[model samples]
Structures are given as structure tokens and as C-alpha cells.
Target: MTVSPATASAPLARTPLDRRVEPDLRVALCAAICVGLALLWWVRGGWIFPLDDAYITLHNARVLIEGHDPNYGVPALVGASSLIHLSLVTAFSLVLPGEAAAYLVAGIGPVLFLAGLLTLAQRLSLPWPEGIALALAGLASGTGQFLNGLETGLVMAAVTWTLVLALDRPSRLLALICGLLPFLRPELGLLSLILMTRQTWSRLAAGSDRAAALRAVAADAALALAAASPWLLWNLAATGALLPRTMAAKQAFFGHPPGSLPASVVYAAAMTAGGIGPAAAALLFLGRDGPGPALLWFVSLFILGFALTNREVLAHNGYRYTFALLPIALFAVMRLGAARGPSVLRLLILAQWAVALAVAVAAPTEIAAQQERVAQYRAVAHWAQANLPQARLLIHDAGVIATASDLPLTDLVGLKSPDSIADHRRWTAPSNGAERFRALDAIARRSGVTHAIILDDAPDHFWASLADDLRRGGWSLDPIETGSARGPYILYRLAPPTDPAAK
Candidate 1:
């Protein structure tokens, strides 16, 4: 008797065709377990360490909430990217509370980032369990310091969502969001856009319908223009240039006689190794046969390129700007799953997560300690606010002091804008520390720049000179010890000197 076609095509081995899903389910469950472990490790660590640039972000948000320009309290070393991102979070926080805003950002950033990448993985035809596992690995690799009490997670979430948009839909609304990336952190955003747009255009070109391609391009352009309008309009109103605050920070920090080439390279290297292991970084760029290796490559390239191009010296506090391009870490993990087999990829991803967890634990607990210093400025800012009527205060340290106090702000650090200072000597040369002190004193006397508060722990060069000048001028310095406050800080009251020169 001849076997029927259906009987001849019977299910292989033991399981019936209808119930052949056990293997996939088992793989998926295992993947879920791996991913869950990594996420658990991350959330276990509450938001700690305000980080190097976190103070700047927090200051910007608080300043906006206090009815000051977002630029107020912006440190000399920070970029406007952080200020812009935090300003939006501040808007949310304003309706709620600062801590509420912080929690919202901490929770929402990861959720949004994970959701977007999962959607993109679906679009790429990755298996659901496999996609989640890869995405989780990518998350662990990219978000090494994500749990920190700052806006880095928000920025990374935005970038991840941006990539998802680029891959899955390529809609104009997504493009608008993508355009906003550069404003948050130009280097990462710009590079990512270049790669994403190129890939998008390539896909569009391959499509049979010319009309569809044209619409996609038009949509991208429209969204980009709309999202970028604020930066351009703000520049026109403030500095008459499309670039606000970014150029100023660059010129001040990297575009000096020494330049910031070494610093840029170091930052790039640190970023590559920061979230995922260095091996992951290498695989991201080198992995050619991965499912979405092109996307991962672009993500990594943009992140690394933007970081290095900034060319600024590494801040001692931490490289907080690295947060902006952190999505590449997630992308790298996804590539690992695609290029290597799922089982091998699972082991590698777990190892990467373990690295991130280790680093997370090793990081110091005193991350947000600077909140105390910010408190110091709050104590004295009241006196300045009541007595002096200036819209902005130039502080020696752009800590919580600037943010806690309801004052528009500037920094004397010469990191934000080298040209803000009349004398180039102070910024370029070490002796300019004395000149800066004298200049601050002169400004206080002439411009009614009410206060020149200094931190006892701040750099000796500038703080010492300012203190000396205040003393010599007979300006009585009233010190408020921090023990009387909620956090660490000092309040100095500068009164007009009995002798004019003594001030």
C-alpha cells in the first residue's frame, strides 16, 4: 500500500506537529530567566551618585522650576544637551515634585528603551524570547550606570527609541524624535542619524514604489525640521547662532591652546568599555553576519564618534555624557544573539551582565553627596536673592547650591564659555586664577553681583584667591557652618568693606 503524503510527512521524532512548541518554549523560558536576573541586579541598586554631569542636569531642572532660564547654574564644563533633556524632565517634575521626576525618569527610561528595542527586534523577525534576551543583554551592556540618580537613563531611552523608530517604521514623528537626539548630545545623535538615515534611504530606494520612497524622505525631513526648531529659534534669540551653549563649552574646554584630543580618545575608550565588556564593543563593530548588525554598528559608531569628537578633558566626577549614547550597548548584545547561536549568545550576554553588575556594585555610594554642597548655596542664595537683584549668579561650583537657590546662574569655572571672561589670561594660564578672583570681586562691586561663595573643598587656585581678595578688601565674611543644615555646605556673606581697597 502506498503511504499517503500526510502520513509520509509525519512529525519528526516523538512530538506531534501541533505540540512541537516545547523546544521554543524551553528556550524562551531560559532566555527570560537570564534577562530577569540582569534586570534584578540593576534595580537592586537604588539611584546613587549624582555623577560628574548629573549635578549640571539636576541644576538645570531645578533652575527651570525656580523660574530661571535652564542655562542658569550650568557649569563651565557642561554642555547644553543635558540642560535641554533635564528641562523637559523638570517640566514633568514641576507639576509633581523633584523626587517624583527622578523616579519617573529612572523607571520610564528603561521601560521605554526596552519596549522600543523589542518592537524593533520583532520587525527584524527575531524570535520573541531571543529578542528579549538579546535586548536584555544589550540593556545590561549599555546601561552600566543607568540606575544612577540622573537623566542618563532618560537620554539612553530616547536614543534606543530613536533607533527602534529608524528600523521599524521610519515615520516622520519618529524622525522628529530622532532629530532631538543631537540637541541632547550632538556627537552621538549626529552620527546615529547619519547611519540611520543612510540605512532608511537604502531601504526606501530598494522599494518598488517611488511614491512611497518620496513620502518617507519627506516625512523624515519634516519631523527633523520641527524637532530642531527650538534650538535654532533659541539661538536666534540668545546668541544669533544655531548652536547655543555647545560651541561655548567646546571652545572653553577643548578648543584651547592645548586642545582636548587626548581627553576625547580617553572618553571614547572608556565609553566602549563602560557598559558592555570591551569584547562586546569589538564584536559590535566587527560582527558582519548578525541579524541587525548594521544597526548595531551604526549605534556603536555614533556613540563612539560623538564622544571622541567632543574633545573635552575628562571630568573627575565621571563621564556622564556617555549616558546619551548608551543604547549601543543593547544593540551590541542583540548582534551577539544574531551572529552567534542563541545558546552561545546567552552565555556571553550573561557574562556581560555580570560585568555590569560587578561595576555597579563597585561604584562608590557617595554619588549624590554633592547635594550637600548644593545646600550650602541655598543658605546664602537667600541673602543674595533678597539683597542683590541680579537675574543670574556666577558660582564657583555648579552644585546643588546653584539649583536649590532660586537664582539665574553662570559659572566662574571658565568651562562653559571661555569668552564669558574678559581676560583670556585667567582661563588659559594658571596665574589667571588670581585674575579671576579680582574679576569676580570687580564684578561684585560694579554689577551688584551680590555673592561670591566658595567651597572649602573646591580647587585652591581660584577659591583661595577669591577668599583672599574678599578679606583684603575688608569685606566681612560671615561663614555658616554646614552642621546646622540638612547637608554639607557653607554660606559666606560678603558685605561692603569699610575701606574701599579692603573689599
Candidate 2:
């Protein structure tokens, strides 16, 4: 009676032999190789950020850590591109100096990005081989942007993790991520909105009771709104605007002459396909089921947003805006191959992995190119900090130099200066160089600007007219002697009008 099978505890269910085998070995190997490639690329480049925008965040982080609002040492505006990103960088800066923080952030970005990729691959139920390929594609697609120290990698990780969690089930954590999305990057809010709406609608359609579905939707909405409220309130209070001044300036710059929308969209799509490697071609034919629709919507909306705002800017930014779409594209491709057969999927993965390996091999050249481009600004920043430390300079590319020099800067581009934004808004005409120069001059005088720094190769009409106006206005223009192959940046020194008539 005591030995009765029902009364006796059954032997614990034996763990499946397959389950005991490490599933992540190949994934881990791929991540190590890719991350090593990224680190190698950074080391070759001397661990410098590849973009000037990164320095802007560094500067702001330093400001925040030093017990000031993240601004260019002037009026407190929400000038940092992402408050959350700035906060993280500021935290790192507290532990390390500004430059060291930048490098540390850059190195950490790929790790977070790869972790998110692996999590997504697991959530998608992809086999380890396919997961390796996905990791490769992600590393190849995102390495440059990650190294550049933009919000690209952080946004990528957030977007991938959010999508993975949302696809599994509704949770408060997912809602929280949705709420915090905009603080990562304003455009990323589109992903949050799309995903939340889709999830809520799916629940409503599937639920037996309409009221229950409505409650769930309301809960999700409330969580998202609550999480997002801080940034919204802060921006409103600090800047009297919901969006950053950068958004307004970008809209003003890129929203015009709205080149053929279809053409812009097509061009962006082509560029994205090329950047994501051979796997992107497979995304075109993937079924709408699985992660395809979410990915398609994300990529389509991004391209459409670029078309409406500034396709040229997207193209010029090394196709960085599209890098966020890479993981999704790779996921779609993996899913397509898996649906066909494991063998087919494995072959596709191999092909994509080979492409990624090529990208890794070529990374050194890309790093060199980026280093050369960034060197000019860095050198000029050092020069200005040393020689013209006291000059109140009006600058076009204000991020690197202003941060580096600790200069009192009036950003003619409007990113750091509310007054510059006001001037930009006041002048609605197409970029007339002389008129633009006059507006800048007005802002300069108002800000007590005694010197100016302008990129000689700047495509804006303002650059075209700068030298002429400098001479006519009793400002002497001298090209800064940075031996950069990119070109010379001009530095102008203001002198009191020699001619009484000019005054």
C-alpha cells in the first residue's frame, strides 16, 4: 500500500537531452567574432567617435554631470538629442572623463545591441545556426553607427527587445518600453505607437469579452502614457515645446522642395537594402505573418518620414537612420528561410554570414575614412580652445568645437541656441545665402559674438555668402590650418568697422 504508484512521487521528468545541449554556443561565437571586429575597428581608429553629433552628447553629458542642464553654456533648453541617452552618458562620465565615457559607451553599444539581437532570435524560435547569421548581419549593419556613438545602437536594442516582448504577450514592461521610446529618439515613437496599436487591436479582436479587451487596452495605454509623461512634461516646461529644437530645425532644413516623394522612398529603400547586405533581398518576398508586418511598417514609415522631412539628410548621414531596420530585415529573412526548410535556412544564413564577414574585413577602411573626417573638427577644436579661448564664436557645426573648446558658442545652426531657432523660423524663404548671413550676423551681434567658424564645404547658401559678408562687415576671414583632406574650415575674427559708413 505504501509503494502504490499513485501515492509515491513519480521520478522527476528527465530533462530532454537536446535541452541540455548549450543552444547559444554558435550564437555566442558569432557575437564574439562580430564584437571583436567592432572593437578592432575602434582601436584602429584610436577609440574616437566617428561623428560630431556624438561629441554633442558628450559635451552635454559633461555639463549635466557638472550640475548644469545639458546645454551649450547658455539658456537652458533641452538641447541634448535624447534625454535618456544623455543621462546614461552623464552617468558614465561621472565614473570616467568625457572622452573615456564616449569610448566606453561606443564599446558597450555593440554588446547591448548583440544581446537584443540574440533575445529576438530566441523569441522568434530561430535555430542556433540562423541565430548566428542574424547576429552577423546585425553586427555588420550596425557597427559603424554604434562606433559613431549616436543613439542608433541603443535605439536598436530597445526596438528589438520591445518587439520581441510585444510579440510574446502584453506586459507592463512592454508598455513601459513603449512609453520610454520617444526619449530614445523621437522617430522611434512611431514603432511604439504602431506596436501598441497592433497589440491592442489584436487583443480586442481575439477576446471573448469586449469589456475585458477594452480594459487591457486602457491599461496598456495608461502605462505607456505614464512612462512617457516625464519627458513630455520636461520638454514642455524647459523648451515650451513638445519636440526638440533639433526637430524644428531639421524640418525647416529638410521639409522643403520635397523632391519626388516616390523617388525618395525608392532611393531610401535601395540604400537600406544595400546596407543590410544580401539578406535584405529576402525581406522583399517574406510573408506578412510573423515579424514581417511590424518590420515592414517600421521601415516603410521611416523611409516615408525621411521622404517628407529630408531624404538628402538621411543619405548624407551614412544611411544611419536606416540602420535601425537591419535586425528586423535579418529576422524576416531568417523566418523566410525557416519556413522553406532548415537546410534552406542554413544555406541562406551562410550566404548572409559570408557577406557580414566581408563587411567586418572592410571595417578598418571605413574606420579610417571616419577618423579622417572627424579629425578636422577635433584639430580645429583644439586650436580654438588654445588660441581663441575667450572669443565668443558663432559657429555652424557647434557640437565638437564648442564642447572641445569650452567656448561660449552661439550655434548658427540653431541646435544649441533658441534665438537661432527664432531667426530660422522668422525667415521662411528658400535659403538665400546673403539673407541667411544677415540673420546669422543679427544673432551674432545679439549674442556678443566676436568670431565665426564655418565649414568651407557647407552646402548651405550661408556658407556661399560668408566670406564676402565677413570682408564687407569688417570681419577678417582666415582658413583654419587643420591639414585635413576633407577641406579647410574658415575662422573669422571681427574687427570694429574701419569705415564709419560700414558701422
TM agreement with the true structure for every prediction: 0.66, 0.83
Q: In model 2, which regions exceed 4 Å deviation?
A: 1-18, 22-46, 69-71, 75-77, 254-258, 283-286, 342-358, 372-376, 425-442, 456-476, 480-487, 495-503
- The number of clashing residue pairs in model 1 is 14
Error of 1 at 203 (Å): 5.2
Candidate 1 structure quality by residue, lDDT tens digits, 1-503: 11111111121233253135534543554456446545744674433234334545555566555644444433222334543556666777777666445555555556566666665554444445666665665555444345555556667677776656554434566666766766665554565466446646665867799887877787777777788787667645644445545444433323332336556555656654553464345344434432245555555564445454442332333455554545655555554444454665467556766775665555534434553444444656665556555545545565454445556554554434333444323432334233344544554565444455565554434344556665654566676443445432345556766666742
Which pairs of residues collide in model 2? none
How many Å off is the CA of 255 in candidate 2? 5.7
Candidate 1 Cα lDDT to native = 0.52
Among these predictions, the greatest lDDT belongs to: 2
Write one digit per residue (lDDT tens) for candidate 2, span 1-503: 01111101111222354244324554565468567756765766556676678877877776655656332555333466677777777788888777667666666667766777665555445655566566756776665677777777777777767756755656778888989988888888898888887778777988699999899899999999999998888778877887566766754533344357788788767777666667777766546664457667777788788766666556555667766677666666656654665676677667777877777777768877666656776777677778876878877665677566777777776777767766655542255233454555556567877777776655655454656655655555556554434444656676545553452
Best by TM-score: 2
Q: What does each candidate score in C-alpha RMSD?
A: 8.3, 7.0
TM-score of 1: 0.66
